[model samples]
Target: MTDTAEAKRSGPNSPQTAFTWRHAGLAAEFATATDGTLRLVRLDRPGSTQRGGAVDARSHDTVAPETALPLVELTALGHGSGWSGPRFTGTAFGTRLAYRGHDSGSRAGWEWLTVELHDPATGLTAFVELTSPTGLPVLRSRVRLRNQGAEPLTVQSVSSLLLGGLPSPDTLHVHRARNDWLAECRWYTEPLRDTVADIHVDAHQHDSRAALALTGRGSWPTDGHLPMGALTERDGGGRTWLWQIESPAGWRWDLGERAHGTYLALNGPTDAEHQWRFHLAPGGELTTVPVALALGSGLDDAMGALTSYRRAVRRPHPDHTALPVVFNDYMNTLMGDPTTEKLLPLIDAAADAGAEYFCIDSGWYDDDTEGWWDSVGAWLPSPRRFPDGGLRAVLDRIRERGMVPGLWLEPEVVGVRSPIASALPPEAFFQRDGVRLTEQGRHQLDLRHPAARAHLDKTVDRIVGDWGVGYLKLDYNIVVDPGTCAPGDLAPGAGLLGHAHAYLDWLFGVLDRHPGLVIENCASGGMRMDGATLAVSQLQSTSDQQDPLLFPPIAAAAPTAVPPEQGAVWAYPQPGYDDDLITFTLGGALLGRVHLSGHLNRMSKHQLGLVRDAVSTYKTIRADLARAVPFWPLGLPGWTDAWLALGMRVPGGASYVSVWRRGGESELSMPVQHLAGGEVRTEILHPSAPDAGTAIWDGDGGGLRVALPRTPGALLIRLTQGAENDHR
Candidate 1:
């Protein structure tokens, strides 16, 4: 099951293949140059050969020193900067690393391969670890560096993964997603040659100095872009490489032309981009953030593999499978102004609508009538807002109505005017140059400090343990740019990295204490949606747009960035809205987590019936969501697309598709290759009314034609194979 071999040099001056590992369908080969520098020359699925064919046997000898990057790229304070390029290449420390040894092992269902390298001059040892699930075409990589010398080493940049031997730029295309407040996961594809232009390398006898780089800075990892990307062959070879950087803070990935073909560098916070530096004393060690790469025949296949990898690595919890429905009084209902008088009736309405949990979002702790945005450190109930038995009374009503109580919390910040701002010591908050860092009237808490962590733990325990709350909507509304720094820290970015890790640790601690509690991750609505946070949090709020018509694209494209069961899409139906609008909003969330919100207490019985019907339908199909793999029949949704479609397929069972007609024609046809050549039985699962929409399955053509008579209508359709083709 485990295979490994070491390559020996044929001659003293010739380049040698240092090591080769083949496991789980992935083959990786490391080569050592004449100078004894180690480089990862090959990483590919040998069984599924591409049109460009395997890498040349003599590429290790022909590749230029600048392009033949080491297996682990390390840049230190006193190292040689780089070659004649803007890229992070040709570092002296990276070039000096020589292959030491390697090992392979298997545990449970996962296999791992570790390659060790050493730099004699600085006594820096690098261990490159690569892991993957058995029989999967996916690989996760991370690097750990140890300083064994007498002198201290300050690391400015270290790559978690460095890959070479990709196809030429002319035969490749790149895909990346742009994200923002209301617009999340807007993906665009471009030719790799356009981003990293070919400067006639053959004529110049050298590779181009330019690189196509994507960098995310600050605490919001996905503020401007998602930490995910893909590169596919342009010749219809179906060779695709999809990758995701696992970090809650700053990260960067770049693709550029190298001597043999192309090279990719994935790293966490770096000195040039995020002012991050790590100080490693003698015998000290540090590990870089992990990154994952999945190879497949196409984009969808690669994404499916990546999805499985994501599900495998995340913290296991019942919430992922149970997927309980949540109702919050914030989106378009109370709007951060919740009171017992306002919530009691809403709680009853939510329970009647089958919401498993009811969360009183925001402003619950504010005694002031003006606002609670600025003064929000201490998470306590407001006596003026709660009255009589206080917030506990509203919670009791929710419990009485058959729903668990929940609360909103922003545990990382203290308002400038709040009492906790002064109660906590200055060291407990982020500070630089002896001054506390403030953003939008709030001071960021440095979770690395014991006082700040203890305060958060106390607040969470009081809310979850004492208050009997089962859900917590954790929201972060402000951004702390550059990062945080202290007297002993190497840089602000380094301090931010430490705080990010510490924050995750605190989250794990909270979950450990309260195993049944569900936490919703919200950072200004999807700004902090990254692999690292999604792996910990139970659910993710897709957006805060508040407009039902504008939410279709966001919900449709959310699965591309998050798992379907965890992407919480809001369904807020106002009393004045029609049945079509209600169904349109609710149908968008059927394939994902249903986050119900609205003025349900003020609606008529007829309107309330529509809401109840949607919830009932969600429950029927919710069990299949945890095992489904998402697909887009009409391709990734465009922001202005008149027709948007999201499909979830559960192998050997049935497939569910949610289609929305925003402002286009009456009919839309999309390809469904999996159901081709088979008889499919289709039915409308939501709205419960036959006249909501119409669908025609073109089994012969492997497509589905849908018609929504209304302009802004949506429908959830289920497709099950006929008995004759059930096994197919």
Candidate 2:
């Protein structure tokens, strides 16, 4: 069969299939309805028979125009009539768009399919582009709009992707994650029927106007909710659709019952939600943010596919392959109060514990005796903190001990009291009504300005080039809501979107200048965790929760949104903690990037030995993490669960599991169904203490029974199937 197949129309008013394309085991069909609207009629496995024919027949008999949604839903001012029902759906211009043509081809490592549509009334053209990695059951989509008419157009909302013809609402379950400052990546599942109430569509002959919508506001894309969701069949059919929107600015998604089945719409920013508007001149064009959709038999399978897609799209860097252990002086240790006297011993201790990079986080640039919170624009080291030879002396010591040196930097914000705030022109800062906007005593920088970009470039060159720093922790601590608007922009959200694009370009330029340096993305920790930011940065700080007892859930759920190798989980073992407590904290980071912290120099010999052992074990298995996919044996974790298990399925049918016991019974059972009916061997990789914990493998039942004698204990276990050599 050919790669692309085109079907001709049979009659003027008769329903006809327009196109059918197949790739990576999935088939997509586009059909023209009786009213001449091009709709995405079906998306399913290649060999599977259609499941909702009878329902679709009934839907056509009742409401022919609402059977399926168009390829793209666009809302523009003064171009189309007003829409009824929900705010973003059923736009007159979108429904009346005429399909021009479609083409398919391969470029680089991706296979792409583009469908073109034209708005005859306004002379607007939209190219809906869909691409996927070769042989991956994942599709990413975005829309490019060009204004070819005489009059200018102001677009209010445009969907990146619209998927229709899903399973019946009564048979589906929706999953979403809620994120906060201390609590992050907490997922919950609900029935789709509950969200979109049944309004007797057959009796009323029209679909419901309400929708189950989720929106993220402000510059922090993932501040309130993650830009991801999934819909799985409640019955035993085992079909799931998991999706993510790739944007670092405002984003919104909605799903509701249509005439034939449920439909999903994913978008970057809309006027109703984020006050965003885009003005297109006669020759101007705009491209929407990209969104990805993966199909699988279950949630885990879909997540694994998404993991592969993420790796395929990310910027190539050595940090992903090396998986080096980094030690930062912040969490529960220096607490952002770093000095030469305080960092010397910690640097030596970190180097002895198998750490390859040491970072001096925050408070390093406090030349004033007063507080440093409102006066942190100058990226220079404090002379008062390092009296003798300056901060360079401490960095030299770190390098002398066979470790790379790093520093903490918040590049997008200038403190209100900073001299740079006044030195730079008003255009360099984010301003509204000719006044700079301040949040938490810090002014946001408009990276779209040349002066602002130049300032950051000079700072990065001096630190990474002249100072020889090899790593940077880029942190953003303020939230600039609605965002900043210039004179011609329609709204603040539009300017914010422009700045987001500029910021990403600036990041690429910095990496081009310093290719070897590693950058870690942080926003008070995990606030800005999205695909766009993660694709450019090497690592992501998962959270800032200082309490070890409350961190296991965050660490366990990090991989669902972030790849294991890129999610930096902190393991801070303090001096006052016992051996079991130390193991508990260290175990949380074994499967992911080990962000080691705490004052190891203050610990005794045995405590230090435990830290060293964890680092060594991580080094042995870190190579496997680059190719591994994560799984949860006991399901997505609860915030206060007694026991939590996170596993990584590596190549050669081997897996590594990290189990944490916070409270309740010491004995717990977790099901690893994939390894069932196979002979398996389990070994404790860390602590090596014979009495720390015991794990019994049940090959027949595909379960692992763990017994930890203490209330707060943890274990890192490696499970290998039937005669496979242990990679570690």
Candidate 3:
């Protein structure tokens, strides 16, 4: 009975079995062995903090605490797993280290019945290791996922790295760049209560807050902020990721479990569509996602040591956090099922108005899209609606109009009436009683099967190669799909999500082949705007907040707006609505993607001018603003409201700040601290206001406060060095 046992399933009365553990070289790293587990303490550098914060216009008090990572907590980390089915009972080598994991349990999915060994790092790296796939230490971890569930199962799962100890006044919040859909922050605030209340993920500032009974409730990915300070060790700076592996349905989750008030999480592929459904023969082995953990640091000086920790071995330094935003001009809804002929004028006008992309939407291909679920997988334009030359002619027209052509595809899904459904090998679909069930406006297509993958790949080649599509809008809305979890490899309980992840994997693979080709993921709006989708596309439409006229202000005001750091970080103001009001409201959303959502032709001349000017102004600050950080005066009284100041600090150069006002007052002064520091001067250039000037103020010591006029609550201030004052 050594710490490293070679035990196996004893058949209730047989010999004990143990998993194998292998260790490699290490200089000063500590390796502690417990009853059946090992801990690799990676000593590293202290955490780093976000340097800047938004300044004030009315009063420039001390800045709010920027992001910080305290070091003392770095020693905290763990690894273990709850047994949904059978887990390894013996010691096993994973991520180059040796550990143990238990197997078999009730409520099998969330069961922690058996034991689990771990080589948990200080929240710096997830213990994503199975037995080595290569040989010993240089690279690899090979392990297996055993499914014990009845019926065919597919396993698609997502795990988050949880960290605590955060910046006050603001718990960690991450919003979709567009909608008010908030995602669960890895950190739980209410000390763990389980109540499902709706918190806006990509919400307007006024709508982002939600009261969740933190303990028992797992908020939907679109209702809460990203939990900040969830690192296992001290926090300052470090990187983490969510990872997953899919089977056709049954699977197990591994994690470290000790109740000393620590942290854990799953990063990287946030919503990889990996649910629990895998169609596994009882006691059968399924494709495993055993050890797909994160790598990062909290120990400042130990960076070099941690960097060479081996687990991060040949992994690429990928940018997983933020994605770019896109603006699409073509409206896609059926709009009461208008005919293409009736829509041509509107579509043509949108293209002429400088729309970044012009899509034919749903009606372009046929007269009836209400039954669109039937039209999918057809891959051809209907003759009834598309008269003489459809897609080809449209492509030519779009290119001539100077805009990229984007086409929509739902490869992971198929319509019951789609011609290809009957053509597809029966294995390509999710079957129940010889019939495939459709859910949420679509039917699921399993992605784990090679045949399925091959089919999808071919479709992309044909569509992109033949149609000359610039962008691919991958709309995923399947709710009952038994997604691909490797051929015959299903997770334990993945219902529709299992197929979802496999489907995403398939699409991402296709995207990889098309260089410079951007993807627009729409899980019926913002449902699929997970990290996986974010990694593949420039931007994702946060929601179906498509009505330009009514949704502009609401779009601009949702609370779960943007990640504090990236784009779509604020609310997006839809077009039309109230041009001036929308102008002022769009202040906070300089980061992430912001696109128009209504008919441009309907706008009055003034509205059109307003939009053109707004877009122009956005271009002017495109480098600094567009998708950068802007500010809103929170905690202010209503009506007697104030203007929002958009400022950019130019490194070693002049900084520009734009103020958009909506509330009364012909004028108001804003503090200019977000701009370049040092001895600087301010100049006001209000294009519409007659009163303006280059005012010389003490810009040092105090923040840069500018006086802005009414109507637009607009003010543009440029900060430049007053001279060569070396003292900052």
Candidate 4:
């Protein structure tokens, strides 16, 4: 059934080529090939800065170096050519790197280099890239290695590359960790109201290694590698699959839909973790990461990308949406004190006063004993907390008001104080001494075990089915061992001792069962947020501290921790002047999800009114805000202004803008591409302050002009018809 090389090569017209050095002493070249569809490269010698002397090319085996040293600089390139060989010439950078191009049919080319190092034990790397005849990047790479001195060495490394691709909006990011069909692991936002975009969409496959990955869009809820949508073959056999790898390498991504930039990076794994992490002796050590960027249509295309690059190219994918705005309220406050008599009224008031979603937090259980990680799976009413009891009755009460009902659960967790742990054998624990430690406070559940599997199934089935919970905010204050865990189940990228991926698989499975259900995956507050797990949850807890001031740091760091889809942010705003409210909501909106855990009933009547109005205004433009093009308007020319004008433009050029004034005077303008490069009339309006109401005709200068009062915040503006399409 396998086709011979000749048979496989016949369908397409291939290119032929070899390497030529234009500037000799400056750079040395070794291998090269060109075919319109295939390219190969190897550098026997590169620039002084590049690294490459002895390398291990064996598929899954380690190799050793012979002497005390090896040149770190080296690179090569290959491509499919129209003719067969020798029509490509190259340019060299000193004696360090070189690049070549063909003057004929093929419109592709490459540049290679051997990056050097100061410390011998540190590491070495190579940089390579793909270019268009017009000189735009199609792909780029950063290959690396560990200099083991004169001895053998082993290590784990990851390559981080940056690409410029399509902009991110309301898109999906998949999780690419391990899968444990048996474990009841799942994902969601840690903070109930902070950020809710961590929602991980399962491709419905149970193969842990075959899950979705984050595309690292915007900065919020989380950072590092956030999840993106899943990738199946361009066909049905399930041969080719793809996922995104995201990071903050300081590159801005703003490509329109049909993105057509050069490929940035495309490297594969040296070992299972997409890298090599090892050691070095008195004279030995190695450190490096290889990134890769690849594309193919068949199943083989997917597998082949993971293979072959074990020792070659390394690249990072482009970035996406980086929103930082969020909504906040006293979500889990009810959980703090489950006494329904006093809490229900408060929950209702909060819901009415403009809170996005009311979180029916914890504390409804019968136990004063329900603290921390204790009492995990006892999904029942605490006779002591609500003596009159009916959890559904309370949930129904909330939903009747036209707002969604969000409930909190810990499916992957079980407390020792609860009946579930005492019911199961203590031997089922993850081992403290040998008997498996079961603290009187909390007993950990081994998700990788069959016993835990059955337990989670029963719990999730009921909580999700019978309860009809829309948002499941699950928390794991403590890390649970993912069992002895199967292969490909380590905390990806980090390769930490915990079976992180195995747990991720279980989480996705549960998400697949509940329709319209949002999963909030959290780790002891700020812990567990990374490239792997972020992609699989709707939202994750960025931090446990809910202070208003802490927001900026979270927003700043968010871009580096998780992708935009999971960029939900949890904030506890200080209730004061409407300025803080405007500031909090506006800032949070710029980031991700926003949440609150304070008393909503205690606010001033004016504050409540303001909230009611903000929520109404927010809903009016929710659709436009949710899926609009994000463009930020600059503040006034000087003096510490807080009011911000965030505008979103639609395809045909219609625009929606929201402005929040903090302290200083507010005056700002936005420029648009509407009006076919000509002039048009503009008008602005706001319920809280002055309404410039439909007015004069002027060109598309500084968007619609806006002005705000000192304390009254949150101004909204809309732009309709404009100039020509090809006027510019």
What are the per-model C-alpha RMSD values against the true structure? 3.2, 3.1, 13.1, 17.0
- Give per-residue CA lDDT, model 4, range 296-375, as digits (tens): 23322322232222111212111112222222233323435656676676567657766645566556554655364565
Candidate 3 lDDT by residue in tens digits, 1-728:
11222323211122222221323211111122322223322311122132111111112222211111110111101222222222121111222222333333222111111223323321111232322212111111223344333443232322222211122212222111222333211122222112212343335332212222111111123322221121222233332212222211222222221111112222212122223333335465533332222222311112112212221222121111222223343443334243446445545655544455554444344545466656577566666665657657666766776767766666677777676777778777665545555555445666666776787888888778777887776665544432333344333134334554566566567656775666665655554434333434544555554432233233233222222222232222344356445454343343324454345556576655555554445445545432232233221112223444444444445565555555456444555544325566555432322342223345453455444444544445556767532111
Q: Least lDDT summed over 10 consecutive residues: which range in candidate 3?
A: 67-76
What stretches of model 3 exceed 4 Å from their correct place? Answer: 1-36, 40-261, 265-348, 432-435, 481-487, 490-501, 546-578, 582-590, 604-606, 623-728
Clash count of each predicted structure? 0, 0, 159, 156
At residue 687, what lDDT does model 4 achieve? 43
Task: Put down candidate 2 lDDT per residue, 1-728, tens digits, no spaces.
Answer: 11444322222233453666666555666776655566777665555442321124223221233467788888888654344656356777777677777677666777677877787778888888888887677889999999988989999889998877665688889999998998999999999989799888999887787789999989888998899999887876667788999998999999888764788889998888888999999989999999998887778878888998999999999999899999999999999889899999999999999899999999999887779888988799999899979999999999999999999999999989999999999899888888889898999999999999999999999999999999999999989889898767788999998898899999999999999999999998999999999999999988999999999999999998899999999999999998889989998999999999999999999899999999999999999999899889999999999999999998575699999998889888889877877777888897677788888886666788888888688888899876433222
RMSD of 1: 3.2
Q: Each model's C-alpha lDDT?
A: 0.85, 0.85, 0.37, 0.38
- lDDT (Cα, tens digit) per residue for candidate 1, span 1-728: 23433322222234554555667567766668666777766666756555211243234233433345787877888885668666766678877887777678777777788777889998999988889877777889999999988899999999998877677888889999999998888988999999788789899998888898998989888999999888888878788888999989999999998874877888888998999999999999999999999887788777877877888888999999998999999998999899888998899889888999999999899996657777889988999999889999899999999898999999999988889999999999999888999999899999999999999999999999999999999999888878888767889999998999999999999999999999999998999899888999999988888889889999998988888999999999999898899888888899999999999999999999999999999999999999888888998888999999999998678999999998878987898877888888778787676677788787767888888888688888889876332111
Clashing residue pairs, candidate 1? none
User: Cα miss at 82, model 4 (Å)?
Assistant: 34
Give the TM-score comparing model 3 with the true structure, all chains together: 0.58
